[model samples]
Target chain A: MTEAVLKVENLQTHFFTKAGVVKSVDDVSFEVGRGKIMGLVGESGSGKSVSGFSIMGLVDHPGRVVGGRILFHGRDLVGLPDEEMRKIRGRRIAMIFQDPMMTLNPVLRIDTQMIETIQAHEKVDRETARQRSRDALGQVGIPSPDERLMAYPHQFSGGMRQRVVIALALAVNPKLVIADEPTTALDVTIQAQILYQMQKLVAEQHMGLIWVTHDLSVVAGLADELCVMYAGRIVERGPVGRLIDAPIHPYTKGLIGSVPSRNPRGQPLTQIPGMAPTPIDLPAGCPFRPRCARASDICRTTPETAEHLPGRFARCFHPHLEDAA
Target chain B: MSVFILRRLMQSLVLLCVMTIIVFAGVYAIGNPIDILISPDATQAEYDRAVRALGLDLPLWQQYLVFLSKLVQGDLGKSFVFNEPALTLVFSRLPATLELAFAAMLLSIVIGIPLGLWAGLRPDSVAGRSIMAGSIFGFSLPNFWQGLMLIMVFSVFLQWLPAGGRGPTANFLGINSSLFTAEGWQHLLLPALNLALFKMSLVIRLTRAGVRETLLLDYVKFARAKGLSSRRVIFVHVFKNILIPLVTVIGLELGSVIAFAVVTETIFAWPGIGKLIIDSIFVLDRPVIVAYLIVIVLMFITINLIVDILYSVLDPRVRLADMKS
Candidate 1:
């Protein structure tokens, strides 16, 4: 197998609040190879976003990576100093946020921000930076890149702002881009366009990607590999096609089944009855034990990530595909 | 954009007219000018002659018209106390006040903003907490008291500097190297510190809040993930976001700095517009009072206009939104 560009091993990120410590990301492990796209899927509070944040070293005060090893190209990133981390952040690894407004500062012109972003990672003159910024905006399918760069964040519609944000992410041409629900705020139509652009860039640049979101449909359309998280831990890991065709964990099955189009027109859409349980007061055993349909006495104890097939992994007392035989 | 500017200008004119009416009414309500005109030694005939010569006997409408016309022609009349044109007195004193306000603002931003950023980025650290505590204390303490304390420590105890005044003597023109010659800076230190202390606490508190808010945004996280150094992330990505609102605060504070100079000047015995206005008020110099009021109001309006223009330049969205609004 090609060496992994990024490897997160047994990571646990906890939030220390007045009430208690919430295990936002607990013992989650995954890998993304060069130019590969990993789809991270889970409901809110499943720790997918937190895991991405941990890898980025963006966790702030009161929330910390208590135990974990974030290996970026074989180098441990967990304990790396902020000064060193900054050198890697925008240059080698980049991130796209959910809200495009966050990515584009409201006070700065589009061109100014994009040019500055380009020059930040490389030693370049204004003309070169401007050309690169224009090219980036063009790559993201922004029409009339020259005029648009002169405009402000408020001038653009929600979708356009998102596209501008995507353009900014592409400015430095980083090797890895972590997109945390980048299209969640965009309309469905705009979402499709952005997704297409993102996929095309990753393929063209051979950059590794971690796409975090709760929407499985988006993952199905975009990701090469899939990892399903519950509470703060990954419950299943496999090829995207295999996971979609035959998901092993009950939690993964429930999620896939819950999709509206997954069922017949006349039938009721599947729903995970209760809200996502709080990470602060997670139940004993598997984090999904409270909602798992196949839970038994054995499930009361925390289950470890166990390999069920040649390359697929699931954290369950009774693996579904194995039992199907 | 031009339309927006035109609208703001019209509004400013209307505001100025309204302010003029209020000032006129206040000046009239204070009492008749007979006491000064007709001293005990003067007879009724002499009093009448004095009143006629002063145009005091003219109808209120006529007096207002004359005053407005003179104002339109850039003639603010003569100062009763200074025996000079009101505009000349204001213009001369204006530089000293502007210098103090500019000095104070520069000191506040230079010292407070960095401290606030440090505090925000490391909320749990000793440096962060100490900065927060200092900010709170600075904001809470009365300006007068702080000015007194500074005077006591820097002037009385240390005897390293002059207690107050524009300079050792007001004979020097602008850019006197004597101030930079070591001895002159010593004279400026106390007044600058006094003005700065009053404004610094505010900048620190506001900056802390602004930084904290910016830190929460996804772009900051994205910046961090991209491996930008903490300084770059905080100053470049985060500072721009925080500084938008900060600029607004700075503009408003500048107006207050001019208005509040009365107290600061008194404490430091500095020769600025505030002291000039105070002395004019005590002497009941009508032309000086009216000229001072008009000058201060116009200063505020112009500064706000500049700030408004800056907003559009900084964030394209704002200019776009303003067009629609």
Candidate 2:
């Protein structure tokens, strides 16, 4: 088996708001192997984004990683100094954000920003860095990258901006790239193209990817493994095919059933009852108990950890597949 | 790009005209046209002659047209008390004010940004909080009070520098007064430091806020997740976004650097344009006041233009289809 390029072990992140502490990412763990894609699928406020932030060491004031081990290529990253982390970032690992503007420097031309991003990691002259930047831009399917590089971020369409951001992430050919819903802001057509480009780059470069998004369809097509998060905890995990085809957790089942394409035409869609539990005031035992259709009296008192399958893990008092026949 | 500039220029001209009208109305409201030029004991003929000489007998519209034409010819009329051309007086002192404004702005950015970056990168730590508190104090304290405190410390007690004035009287223009000579720079140090301190606090606090906000952006997290160093996360990903909003404040504040210098110059007896304006206001020097008004307006318009151009250059979304083939 290939070695894992990124491993997040027993991570916990909390937000100390004025009201109370919100356990945004509670005791979650996952790994992405070399050249593989790991999908973190959850709804808004489910802490999927928080988990990504924890891994990146980007948690801000009032929100912090209280406990965790972020292992990138077998090195601990939790308390690493910022200067050292900077060297590793963009060189060995790269990230693309959901908003292209966030990833870009608005006052800089595309070429200038991209070239600077590349040179930040590598010791290359201007011409060499420029060439790499051009190649990366073209690889992401930007037309006439040379000319486009002279333009600023405001000149590009949403799709094109995302493409530029993707190109920047790939410029250094890093071993790992974390994409936080990179195409969420784009139109469907553009989203498809970006996804295809990202997949192609991951394959061609043999790099690991963590694709964080709520869209199950995108994850289904792109990810090798899937981790379903609910209320800051991993509710279910498995191979993408197995998880979607035969989901174990009730939440996962509801999520899959609720997808419009999965239901019959004009039929009432299946949705998990109840709202997502607030991280600040989560119920005892399993976080999903309030909404879990299969939940029993025992689910209210004691949390259950799924017996790890050979290659998958889920947390539940009563996983469905074992009794599904 | 050209269109953007032209649009801004037209807007600036209209704004300037409106500002000039406001100034004229303010001046007209203070005293009757005849009263401004003739004594109470003067005969009716004397009053009439003075009114006609000043074009005060014309209709308001005609008066405005003459004012506009005179302005176009670079004549702002004579001072009511000093009897000097306003344009000449304003022009003569323009360089000194520009120097002060430039000096203050440079000081603010040079000291504020790095300090704020350091404070933000470690918000929870003692050193970070201390710096933040100091910056807050700097921002909150009145500029005049800060200037006085500096005078007490550096001039009265320490006696390390002169109390006030542009430079030593000896060889005042003998290459020593131009910031080139050691003595000239020494003389400038106190005023520059005072200006820097006053504005530095504001920019620092602002930068801290900007950095803190940018820290949570998904792109910054993505960069961190890529195992990029904290400096890169802060400088490249975080700082870039932080700087965009900060630039607006910085540009606007550049005008204030001159405005605020009035107090600082008065305290130190520095020969900057702010002091000149104050002197003109006391003597009711119309030409000097008008010229000062025009210069101030021009400064603000130009700074805003630079900011807009900068935004378009840095952000691709600002430009339309111009960059695309």
For model 1, residues B35-114, the per-residue Cα lDDT tens digits are 65356798889988866765678887787888899889888777655569988888778877777777778888899888
lDDT of 2 by residue, A46-92 (tens): 99988876766668767998997989989998988777766776677
Quote each prediction's TM-score: 0.88, 0.79
Best by TM-score: 1
What shift in Å separates residue B210 of candidate 2 from its native position after superposition?
2.7
Tens digits of per-residue lDDT for model 1, A1-325: 4879899999999999999999999898999998889999988888898888788788876899999798999999898986677677777788888888666666667887777677767889999999988888888888999999888778899999988877887788788889999999899998998889889999999999999999999989899999999889999999998888788998888888888887989998787666678878988888777776788999999999998897889999877885332
What does the lDDT come to for candidate 2?
0.79
- The regions of model 2 sitting more than 4 angstroms off are A1-23, A27-31, A57-88, A300-313, A321-325, B1-106, B118-154, B168-198, B225-229, B232-325
Instruction: Report candidate 1's interface RMSD in Å.
Output: 2.4
- Model 1, stretches more than 4 Å misplaced? A1-3, A71-75, A81-84, A109-136, A144-157, A160-175, A205-207, A322-325, B1-10, B36-38, B69-84, B168-186, B320-325
Steric overlap count per candidate = 17, 25
lDDT of model 1, residue A51: 88
**Interface root mean square deviation for model 2, in Å?**
3.7
Which candidate should be chosen as best, given lDDT against the real structure? 1
